[model samples]
Target: MAQRSRVRCGHGRLVALAVMAGSLVMTGAPGASAKGAAGVRPPGDGDTPMCRLTAGPFQRQVEKDLGLPQDGEQSEQDCAAIRKLQNTYGISPADGYAGLVSHRAAVVDWATRHKATLTGCAGRSRRLVCVDQTHQLLWVQQDRKIVFGPVPARTGMPGHRTRNGSHRIYRRVEKFWSSLYDAAMPFSQFFDRGQALHASYRPIFEDPGSHGCVNLRYEDARRLWSMLHVGDGVTVWGTREGA
Candidate 1:
């Protein structure tokens, strides 16, 4: 087991949170609460509501709130576009929602605004463009191009393998703890449950070790952290076969 530490997000652009005032006002609908209510669930709580909200209005509202592109309706194409955007920036969508949901909207908005692209190659900052345990690699992009290289990395062991799906750089800390080893260590924010990308002292990369953290070079981790901000995207591509 290894010690885990928090990754510092540092200072950067301020991510704007959407105004929930309008949406918070309940219409007294079936699932909605009355006016001035605080804990009201929306129209679709446990059971999926009868009226499926169109992706068009939702997308429009998201765009208007986050100042991103209006990608038409929430068709398959729109979903794919959103997924692509999420992958490029490493954020996830809701289980059944079309576009980026409330928590992930800020990240998607930032990636869209910065015009960051998803590439098969590597980044110029010596960042790890990790898709999964087997497909992880060190990469750099120069002149707007990607370059990749094979580098050692440590991933979560069998039962505690790094989680799959899209994520974002939410809150970051300077020091973190490894629940598996109960030691202090360094880490970055990619998941909520104490998972991170950090530095490893041993040859853990050659073998599947670590509770749920992604072990990388100290400098590499810092560089990647600096390049990222809260709400930046993070897409973990699962096992190598699919990545």
Candidate 2:
């Protein structure tokens, strides 16, 4: 007999779960979604299959740098959160142990590229905002090293593209409301024209793109708020193809 797990959604709908022969089985509401289950994201149909994904490289990298396992036996709830982070951060969404491995691998890649770009920050001023549009990554660098980040970022979507080029932080506001969409922008640092770099809660990984500003995760935005100031160097480089 399989142990049954039951869950209730935000709207009071019920979900029944079971594990049979080492596989997850959900025999509940026909439209059961991850959003309905404990506020975690559902698993994604990943670019790479689980069988093809490997843990060796990511584990070794994490051990060397962060000194942690890529991931060990994660619970359903934990798996949900892990999946959420991977997708929300634009990392690979391989399932189970493989997904965890891919996430770590992504972190290693970002760190390496971000470090290399720090060379350009050499001999710069007090702060440097390096935006690599090709990678959709943003990191704060200072004096030949990274101060914070290599966080996931997204520029404007296809119709309204983010302008590329070196610019300066002309203005900063902790909280700004956009009349264009009535959206909330936090830790906004305007550099080029009306386009700004601010905290974005929008789900870019889900295919919802931005208008023109560089959208960053909330925590990443908060970090920038504490680190950046008006008149800091903001260099936007590369181009997001078909973005």
Model 2 Cα lDDT, one tens digit per residue, 146-207: 87777767676666577777788998878776644546777788888878888866433323
Off by over 4 Å in 1: 1-129, 138-151, 240-243
Task: Summing lDDT over every window of 10 consecutive residues in candidate 1, give the lowest-scoring window.
Answer: 9-18
Residue-pair clashes per prediction, in order, are 22, 0
Candidate 1 on 140-160: residue-level lDDT in tens? 334544432233345565666
Model 2 stretches with alpha carbons more than 4 Å out: 1-109, 112-124, 241-243
Best by TM-score: 2
lDDT of 2 at 208: 27
lDDT score for residue 204 of model 1: 26
lDDT of 2: 0.53
Candidate 2 C-alpha error for residue 160, in Å = 1.7
lDDT of each: 0.41, 0.53
lDDT of 2 at 33: 24
